[model samples]
Target: MKFFTAVAFLTASVSAFTTMTPNKVASSNAMAFSQFSQQSALMAAKQVPHGGVLVNQMTDDKDAAIAKATVEIQASERQLCDVELIMNGGFSPLTGFMDEAAYNSVVENMALEDGTIFGLPVVYDTDDESLQPGTTILLKQGDLPIATVELTDKYVPNKVLECKQCYGTSELEHPGTLMVATERGKYYMGGKVTGLNTPVRDFPCKTPAEVREELPDDKDVVAFQCRNPVHRAHYELFTRALDDPLIGEGGIVLVHPTCGPTQADDIPGTTRYKTYEVLKEETANPRVVWEYLPYSMHMAGPREAIQHMIIRKNFGCTHFIIGRDMAGSKSSITGEDYYGAYDAQDIAKANAEKLGVTPVPSLNLVFTEEEGYTTADEAKEKGLSIQKLSGTKFRKMLRGGEDIPEWFAFKSVVKVLRENI
Candidate 1:
C-alpha cells in the first residue's frame, strides 16, 4: 500500500497557541449547571483513558516494523474518522475499536469494564464472515491503509436493545436509530488497532497532543463545539461566556467544529471550515481559538453530550460549552425531536463533576436593533427591540439569493455558502 510520507512533518505546521485564565466556578443558581470546585488540579499533560496511557499505534517511524500477512478490509467514512482519532490520540485511551467486553459494557451500561464512564460502544461492524476471532486485518479507506486491527472477538449485537439503550428510542425515523438498524452490519469486530497512517483530509486536523503543545499548562481552555457555521448570535454567546463570573478573566474560547460527516442537509465541512477561517481573520479575536475535530456525529443527544465531554477532556479542555439539545437529532419521518431541549445539559451537568471538566451552558443570545446583541433575558429585561431569523428562513434566503442581513451572519461566510451552493 502507498504510504503518506509526510506524516512526520504534520506537527511542524501547527500554529502557535495562546492560553486563557481558568473559569470561575458556576454559581449555585446557575441554570442547568453545577458549581465547579477542582477535585484535583488539571493534569499537567492531557488525559488518557482509564489506564492513563495514550494508545498510539502508528508506525510512522519504521517501515520494517510493519505488520505482515495482514488481511485488508475496506472502511466506511465513520470508521475512517475513528481511525484518524485513534491514531492521533484524539480518542486517547482507546487503543482501537472496543472488544466484546468493552462493547457490551458500554452498550448495556454507560461504563467500561473498570466502571469508567464511556457513552458509546465504539465497535467495528462487518458482514464478512471471513473476519473471525484471531484474524488480523488491515483497515483501509479505499487505497490508503490506515490501521491494522487484530480481531479478538466477533459478536452480533442486540440492535433493538442498543437503539433503546443508547439512543433512547427504537423508532426508525430517528437518524441514530435508523443508523443502528440499517447502516451497521449484523456483526461487530473488536480488537487492538495499530495505526499505519492518517487519511488525507481537505482541511487541517491537528491531533490532541499537537493542540496540547500549543496550550499553556496553567490556563483553562473552554471549548465551543459546533456542527454549523457561526453567526452573530453564536459569536455573542461564546464571547459573553468568557465574561461570565463563571469564566474568569483571560479565559479563551476555542471554536472547535466537527469537520466530519453530519446530517445530510447540514452545511458541508469544507464550507464551514472556510467560514471559520474568514471569521477568525476578520474579527481577530485573540481570546478566541480555532480548531477542527474529525468526528462523525451520531446525533445521540444526551449520551452524545457526555461522549463529547469525555472527548474534550482528552483534548485538554477545562470546560465545554453545552447548548440546548446538544447533539440532538430528529426523526426524519415524523419531524419530531427525539431528545428534550435540555437533555444534554442535564446529563452533562450530572457527569461533569466526575469527568473533571466543567460544563459551560450557552446562553440564548439574540440580536437587538439598539443593543446590537444580548442574551434573550437581557433583551427582555431592558425591553430592547429584538430581531430574529429562523434557520429555515435563513436557508430559504440563501437558496433564493435573497438578502441575509449583516447582523445575522458574516458576508464572507454567506459568500462562501453561496458559492458552494
Candidate 2:
C-alpha cells in the first residue's frame, strides 16, 4: 500500500502550492499560519486555497496583498548568526532542515544571499517601501511564516475577491480593478476616510507588541511618518521636526513608508525597504522607529499630500514630514499644474483637527556643495546657488543613464534607483 501510494504521489504532479482541483485527500496535517496573521490566511484560503491555480491575474480568486521586505538583523551584528532559509507565501519555520554539513555545502557553492534554500516566503516587489505586507519569512528547521501581507480587498465569507478599492475622493472616478486583499490594508478609502481602519488589517498588525512593551518609557511619543525614502531632504525635515519643542519630546522619529501603489519612475519598494534597512543599520539616531505603513498610493498629487497628513495623524503620528509636492502629479495639458504643491501645509493648517496631526512642511531642496538643506534664505547667505532637479529632469537623467552626483543624491541611493527604477 505504501509503495502504491508513493507511486501515485510521484506520478501525479500534485501542486506544492494551492489545491485548486476537486481531489479530496483528507489529510489532518495542514500547514499552519502564525497566530498573529493566521485568521486572515484561513479566511483567504477558504476562497482561493493554498497554491490554488490562478485562472487569471486580473480577477483571480486570490488574496491580493501589498508587501515589503527588510533585512532585519543588524549588518554589524556578530558576523550574523546561522542565517535562516526563508520560504515564500507564509512565515513558516522549516524544521529538521538539512544538516549543517549540507547547509555548509550549499553556502560554499553559492553566494550567501543567493542561497537556494527558500526558508522564507518572499515576493520580489520592488514597489514596496519598507517591506510591508504580502511576504512570508521562514526560519530554518521550522515552519515558513508569511509576514504581515495585507489585503487590499474586503473579505466576505466564501468569496475573497469581492471588494472595491477606495476612490481617492468623490467627484473623482474610481479606477479600480477587482481584487482580494489581505491584512494591513483597506479596500475603500485606503484608510483615508476611516483613518487606518482597524477592520482593514487581517492580523493584530500592532507594533510587534514586544516593541511597544520595550519602548522607552517616554512621557510622549512624537512619531514621524515617512511616506518616502530617507532622502537628504527628508533627513533635514526630520531634523527640523526633531528640533521642534512641540514635537521634541522623547524625540521619536518613526519612518513609516507606504506599503501600496506609487507612480511610475518612482523608486521601487524594495529599494525603499533597503534604504530604511541601511538607515536603521547605520544611523546614529536611537530615537528613530521604523514601521511599515500599508496605505496604497493614489498618485492624486496634492490631494494625496493632504491624505497622507490626515492618515498619518490617524496612525498616531504626532507630526508628518510634508515635503514639496508631497504626492505631486502633472496636469494633462502643457505638463503644467502640479497637484497640491502647497496642499500639505494648506491641509494641515486648515484641517488639523480633521486631519488629526501637525504638518512639518519643507520646500523642495537641492544639495549645495556648501549648504546642506538650504532654502532661498540660506542659499543667499551661504553664497551657495541651489540647483534643484525637477521630477521630470530626475526621471530623464535616470533613463539616460546619467550619473547622479552627491550634489543631487547619495551614491548609494542613486545606485538603488538606477537598478530598481
Candidate 3:
C-alpha cells in the first residue's frame, strides 16, 4: 500500500516537468553547459566492476530455498539494507556475509583475504549462542522471507578494534562507534547467501546490471553520493562536475543518494526519498540520472569514501565526486571534528588510479547575490555578496513555515519536506 501511495504521488509530481515549455527546457540545458565547450569532446570508457565480477545471489527457485532453511531469524533494518545491496550486486564481490577470516582481514587491513581493497567488513551478527555452524538460517524482514544463508563459520569479533580501525575512534560519542559498541550483536556469522525476494521499500533501488544497461557505454558516469536532500548548492556542484577536466567529455552525472539508515538525528529515508523524487521530476535533466542506494551510512570518513567509490564502480561509474569531509562525523560530547576537511579527498585521490575510478574534488561553491553560485575563492576575489544560511536557521525557518530563499534550496524540495515533516 505504501509503494502504491508513493507511486501516485510521483505520478502527480512528474506532471510539473511536463508543464514546462520546450523553450524553457532548451534554455535550462543551454545554461547548464554554457561554460563547458570542451565537454562534448571528452570520452571516458566505463570501468569494470570490482573483483572483475558483479555478484548476484538471488535464487530462481524460491520454494527450494524456503525448504533449505532450518531456522528463521528476523533481520534488523541495517541487515535488511545490506541484504538488498548484496542481492542486487550493489555490494559486488560479496556473495554472502563475510566469514571470520574475511572479517578479521578487513578489520586489520582495509582489504579482503586476497588483498582486494574493501572499505569495511560486511558480516551478519547475532547474540544467539545456540546457533551452530552448517545450519541454514532464513533471513526475514518481518514475516517476509528475503534471503537464506548457509552458515559456514561463526566467531566473536573484537568491537573495540573494529571501531578503532574502521572508524578511527573508540568513543561512544561517535555514532558509528556507538552502533558497533551497543547496536551490533556479540557474534559475527559468515556464509553464502541465496536471496529469495527483495524487500519492499519506499524507494526502489535498481540492480547494478539494470543501472549499467541505462548508462552510456562510451561516456563516463560521474557518481555523486549524498545522505541528505539535494539543496541548490549541491545541485550546482554535481551538474558542474561534468565539466571537470578529470571527467571524460560528454559524461553524465549519476545523482545517487543513499536512502537507508543514517544518523539517528538525520531525516528519515522515506522523507528524503520524497524530496529526491520531486526534485528529479522538476529538474527533468537528460544528462542526469537519478537513483537511490540502499546503503547504511558508517560515517567512516576516508575509508567510507573509498567504499563508496568501489560501490559506484560496480554500478559502471568511471569517476566519483569526492566532496569535503565526506562521510565525516563528529564527537557528540566535545563537538570536535573527527577527520580533516580534505582527508576524504586526499585519500580518494591517492587511491583513484589503482581503483580505476577517477576522483573529482567538489568545488567549494558559495552562493553570491551578484553572480549566483561561484567558487568561494572567486567570490572573495570579486568581493561579491555571499549569501549564508546555517542548518539550524534553515530548520527553524522550515518549522515556522517561513519562506526559504530560493537561492539556497529548491522550492519543490522544500515543499515536499514541509508537507512530509
Candidate number that wins on lDDT, 1 or 2: 1
- Per-candidate TM-scores read 0.87, 0.48, 0.89
| Top candidate (lDDT) | 3
Candidate 3: give the clashing pairs.
42-249
Best by TM-score: 3
Quality of model 3 by C-alpha lDDT: 0.81
Candidate 1 clashing pairs, residues 3+ apart or interchain: 21-250, 24-246
Candidate 2 lDDT score at position 214: 33
Candidate 1 versus the native: TM-score? Answer: 0.87
Question: Could you give the candidate ranking by TM-score, starting with the highest?
Answer: 3, 1, 2
| Candidates arranged by lDDT, highest first | 3, 1, 2
Q: Per-residue lDDT for 370 in model 1?
A: 99
- Once superposed on the true structure, which residue ranges of model 1 sit more than 4 Å away at CA? 1-51, 61-66
Residue-level lDDT of model 3, residues 193-312, one tens digit each, is: 788988878888987877887788888899999999999999999999999988878899999999889888888999999999999999999999999898999899998999999899
Q: Report lDDT per candidate.
A: 0.73, 0.37, 0.81
